[model samples]
Target: MNSKTVAELLSQDVTLQDVTVKGWVRTFRANRFIALNDGSTINNIQCVVDFENFDEALLKRVTTGAAIHITGELVESQGKGQSVEIVVKTLEILGDSDPETYPIQPKKHSFEFLRENAHLRTRTNTFSAVMRLRSSLSFAIHKYFNENGFYYMHTPIVTASDAEGAGETFKVTNLDIKNPPLNEDGSVNYKEDFFGKETNLTVSGQLEAESYAMSLGKVYTFGPTFRAENSNTTRHLSEFWMIEPEVAFMDLAGNMDLAEDFMKSVLSYILDNNRDDLEFLDKRLLDEDKTKPQAERSDMSLIEKIKFVVDNNFKRVSYTEAIDILRNCKPNKKKKFKYIIEEWGADLQSEHERFLVEKHFKCPVILFDYPANIKAFYMRLNEDGKTVRAMDILFPGIGEMVGGSQREERLDVLKEKMKALDISEEELWWYLDLRKYGTAVHSGFGLGFERLVMFATGMGNIRDVIPYPRTPQNAEF
Candidate 1:
């Protein structure tokens, strides 16, 4: 079979048959072996060449990152280490990469260095694996949504609504930042802004996606989302991606089920489709301990872990129960949290979220029904008058991978909640019009795309997964 995939070529029986392969040299060993890896997979296949047949001068010109094509006969290596090998008959240099200029080498380079060379970092084994997994998971997301009859909706990137509630937004202005139009009260006049009014990059597509879900039955949006938040923490990024699915006839329970199933599906697809890449990552970059602390290990062994999670059902719990358990924990017996979590009235911080998922639940936990006062104004109010219909799916290593809620369908209730939250009603006229025209009980949740990658690949930072990360004060590409 004619295939372009390196993974496929490695596994298939091509031994003693003429085949062509092209890739950059990851490593060269023993003056007779070339460790070749294409962007196709993480694992580099060993090509054993006889120095007697090939000119040493030509081989010497080929450095670490040089692109070359090999006409070879694949052979089963009974050698001590590798399973298979390729005996190269003809080696041709397609492109020569300068050894001094190529930033990536056989030696270990810092993550910060890789960030500076974001354009070239993809050639590295770790990044190649990450990008492959990323591409596979993205396809899996579409597959899961499409198979379930969910329409893939595209949401606008430039929006007037700042839905994240983070309050940190990048202003899209045509006027000069030094001196811009201002009202008599000295506030920036938004009326004259671009789009002929106030506008900013969208933080979430949930609001826009909701409008389509109400009519389309079930719809989802997957795209680039921007946040102007100034937080420089590893978990925070200015520009990221999100996958949000809204179901018109769904409630909080249905939303939870979708989140769990969606996550499992993505994990399962990566494990199945990218098994060789993941296996190489596990052997080279992942920690030696089966249960090692999360680190930047090249051998992430993600495929095995993903399969294990897919085979198991996620644990579910309520927010109220989690609070009670945290309060009674032996470690917290004498210690009070800074923003103390009381039984149904407080917000859950990352620490609390981490403690619950990593320590108590010991697996992926879907926690729901948080108090209305701490949640966004869009959430539906519960009968108890204290909590809203919201849920957050927390995983063992990453906390709050998904956050969503059942939107308030009642016009008056929504307006009341908006008023209490001190959100300007005038800014949300179009959003209100949806309820006036034809409102249906709908639910949706925003899955932080980077968080999903981090969880799936065991990458530590939000910055690592995204190319050219746009964190506060660090937009250098």
Candidate 2:
């Protein structure tokens, strides 16, 4: 008989005379019942074992985390919590896991402990559900872009440009570190490197995506991005995935419309397709919040929160208005914020963003027209020359989920901004050439993939949403 997955069997109403199912044993109870999962779904398929007919040695091998193949007769389950079950006629142990050494057991384990055993963390229910949701969200992103006439562009991973200009980039080199080639001035000779010049992992694909968008009309880059910052916070990751979409002949208003629509589309996809996983996570989050103080608890469930974001329109406010509100808000007035908002040009921190989204607006908020000095050099300069056409979408508990802007397409304005920022004109001659030739108003936004997954799965830590998280001093497996 052909093998069937737990998900397929659970969805069927008719019983099968004979079937084969292969998966790892989640739990072996009473030496007569087994809960099997193959990572196909959040729920496990129950397998009833006739231990009296089976050999003692084989029955004992049906331990937790053990790989096994079972051929059985499918029948209506008489037990609770399941509709159908497998009555095992034949059993084979593919791999045996020693209970003494195997790290994953049939019990709740702390996230910290699971991080240490990341290679095997998927065996747990939480991690498996998270991974499934992440996969679905990825597909939803591609589907949304493809349906919207946007071509998926593959930008280079290794490049010689600093897109963000933050100076926190992971250097890509093949030269020996202990004894590297040096010039007469005792400077490290980058000529000996593989690229014949300094290169690093890309921090963002927006620059390259823009080049394609100018020609292709609309294009998006979804790929891994790296940063060398040593932040150990739950929100920071050394390596993460980013979604950047660039559209030609689009203004700041069009950019905001695209961002809002794109977010709702992808989130609505999750709600429609991944209902089981969302329910599991919703309960998990409620249980987790029980340990926190009442004030810190979430008012809406995971499903309700996602539905709210989809059903309601995001609140839009200008940077000036947001600054005014923050300057007079209770947190800033009472000095509760770690970084107080004092003036107009001051950059808003995460605390201030959360206040606007969770406390003040009580919904998703889009703040635009940021101070030019605080935003990236590529953002479009306003007529007043004090602010740029940049916008950030802030969500409850997850601040700044999307950051983007209408790009500075004017050659003279871009050159002036770059020159004042001390950016090397020679290095970015090709980029400047795009503006020199045929510049049109272009807009785009970048959304961190893991951050979206974190928000969707109700996972607190960004590390938990990603499969293998990379952070400061931690890259194991």
Candidate 3:
């Protein structure tokens, strides 16, 4: 018979049925219990082998982190603290892992230690759960986009223009490190670079996705994007994946709706499929208030808090009202704020976002019409001339997971904004030509893949969600 999944094997009512399972040993308890997991779900299947029948050599080979194939009899376990278990009939040692060398022991390992040993970190319980959830979320995103008539477009990792306008792009160059090309002014010679002009890693795929969206009607680009920002916080990563969706003939409200739908679909799918893994995370990772209710103690254990986001409509607020709310607040609430949300032009900090989502609104909040001076040059300017048509989706725990805007569709207006912002109008000629040829009202959003995973899994750090995080000075794995 083919190898049965742990989930399938556990759910059956039969006892003492023949079974085969292949996985790496997670823990070996009392020289009798072998906890094995195939990197399937977070939960591991316990294989109980009698001391006499268990081969000494085989048992020795089945060290922690060793890959093993086990032939066993499935039984409804009543002994110890397990629900379902397998009684080993014959055990095969697939691969041996030296206990002395393996870093991921049964003992508790810190996140910092795990970051160092990035290659082996995936074998740990937390990382395993995160990896599974990440895979499921990726599938969920593709499924949602495909079902909703969205074409998946692959955008270039390298681009002439840095989409975010944040000036944190990692430069790509072919100049020799020892004796690099120099200009007459003693500056780095970009003309000698591979692209002729200056080129760098793309910060966002929104612009390229927008081009496809204009022609394809609806398109999304899902891939890795890099940034050289020197942020060492749990939220920032040097390299991370992004899911950017751009749609033509879509305004700000329509864009918000798409974001809401996309988030809901992905969350709902992961909550449904990865209940076991998520439940393990909830009990292990989340706060006490986030724990599942007694009535919903089994089925909906994974995503008790997320149901509110999926079921209810999000609260929408403009930048103007957000400032007023922050300014007119009582003295007690004023002291709680890290940075005072004084005016409309100020960038909304994480504190402000959290206040709106967690305290004031008590739901997900969509803040739109951000100040033009603070936003990118390509955003459509509002009539007030102070703000632009940008929007950010703020959740309870994680703030600003999705930041996007309606692109300025007029050639003249875009040019003027580019000039005012001191951006290179020559470099953006192709982008401006898009507006001149046939520009339809379009909108899109960039959902940080790590942030989404962080929100979904209740994992606090962006690094915890990504396998090998590329933070500044921390690229060991």
Best by lDDT: 2
Off by over 4 Å in 3: 286-302, 331-333
- Tens digit of per-residue lDDT, candidate 1, span 277-395: 67766654444444565542222245555654576676788888888987787546756555555455667777778777656766677888887878898999999888889999876
> Regarding lDDT, does 2 or 3 come out ahead?
2
lDDT tens readout by residue for model 2, 1-477: 789999998887889778899999999999999999999999999999987899998898889999999999999999999989999999999999998899999888999999999999999989999999999999999999999999999999999999989999999999999999999999999999999999999999999999999999999999999999989998999999999999999999999999999999999999999899999999999998999999889888899888878988899999999999999998899999999999999988888998998889888999999999999999999999999999999987778899999999999999999999999999999899889888899999999999999999999899999989999999989
Model 1: lDDT to the true structure: 0.80
If ranked by lDDT, best first, what sequence of candidates would result? Answer: 2, 3, 1
- List the pairs of residues colliding in candidate 2: none
Tell how far residue 139 is off in model 2, in angstroms: 0.3
Which digits, one per residue and each the tens of the lDDT, describe model 3 over residues 1-477?
A: 699876666667887679898988988988899988887667788999898987687778879999888888888886865678998888888789999989999888888898888899988878888889999999999999999999998999888997767789998888887888999998888888888988899998888888888889999999999999999998999999999999999999999999988888899998789887788788775444346576423323237557767876888899889888877776325576778655557887887887778778878899999989888888998888788899999987667879999989988888898888788878877787789888889999898899888888877688989888899888774
Stretches > 4 Å off in candidate 2: none
How close is every model to the real structure, measured as TM-score? 0.91, 0.98, 0.93
What total of clashing residue pairs does each candidate reach? 8, 0, 0
Against the reference, the lDDT scores of all candidates come to 0.80, 0.93, 0.84
